[model samples]
Target: MKPRSTLVRILAMATAAGALAWAVTAGNQPSHAATGPVADAGPGYAVEDYGYPNADKILAEKGILLKCGDGYIVLADCASEQNLLRFLARDRADVCFKVTGEKGYLALELESVHGVRTSDVSTTHLEMTAENDRVTYDIPAKTWEGVGESADGREHTLVEIRTTK
Candidate 1:
């Protein structure tokens, strides 16, 4: 093989280095802003239908059993052992008394799913929020990964608490 000219080698090296740097920077950038007006970021997974007694019958009977946007709301099935209903109820009370007495929406995210059956998981990515004293949740995409009910009886993975303005 013949030795490449110095100019050619330097040019090739510079181009490779520049591409590498761009890739790293782009990968490190935040995919979405954490605290901003809720906007759909193309298509992705998120949590949805997050609230206390997240059922229609239960909500009507209990009369808003838990405050919106409070972390203490039992998002999962109440019959499940991993249910956080009691704990969330207590926390909701505390949060209600501490804040400006304004209603807020609670949001939850199932960050990742593991040791769970694929059949039990929802294919759609969900996003939930409470506004105007009503809980509104939506699925961002028709299909998503990393969401499923645990086979070992563990239901929820990641829970997030947020308030809507």
Candidate 2:
């Protein structure tokens, strides 16, 4: 009877040890199912494309096609603020932009832009294309300068505006 009891106790202990070893091995293995802090980590990372916000609305309403920008230079209401960078177009009304930071850049399409009035904050560079020819103008700060067709007799389209302090 003593030998039988001892054998039973040893069998129970061996079974318990096997179960614990199995549990530890299974726990150490990587799980396909998502759980715990890794699963609860919320959303993924965000990538910025630097596209102009509300560009479709502005294009539809104001006939100005704003493409991309560095976020420092933004479209603005001409009447909303003073010292805005203003543009003079052939058929369209004056378009304005607000400049911030040490440098700013904007790529857009405004047709027949003949002149530009740069703000007092920074010097502005205008890039335009006329009849397969690309032209660039460097305008001093706080000055109104002739650009595109205003400089040449041919019609020109404003393509980009870059500013630096």
lDDT scores in order: 0.35, 0.90
Task: At residue 132, give the lDDT of candidate 1.
Answer: 20
Query: Candidate 2 at residue 124, lDDT?
Result: 94
TM-scores of all models? 0.19, 0.76
Q: Tell me the number of clashing residue pairs for each predicted model.
A: 3, 0
Show model 2 residue runs off by greater than 4 Å: 1-44
Task: List, residue by residue over 57-78, the lDDT tens digit for candidate 1.
Answer: 6445443334345442234443
RMSD of 2: 6.7
Off by over 4 Å in 1: 1-4, 32-165
Error of 2 at 155 (Å): 1.3
Number of clashing residue pairs, candidate 2: 0
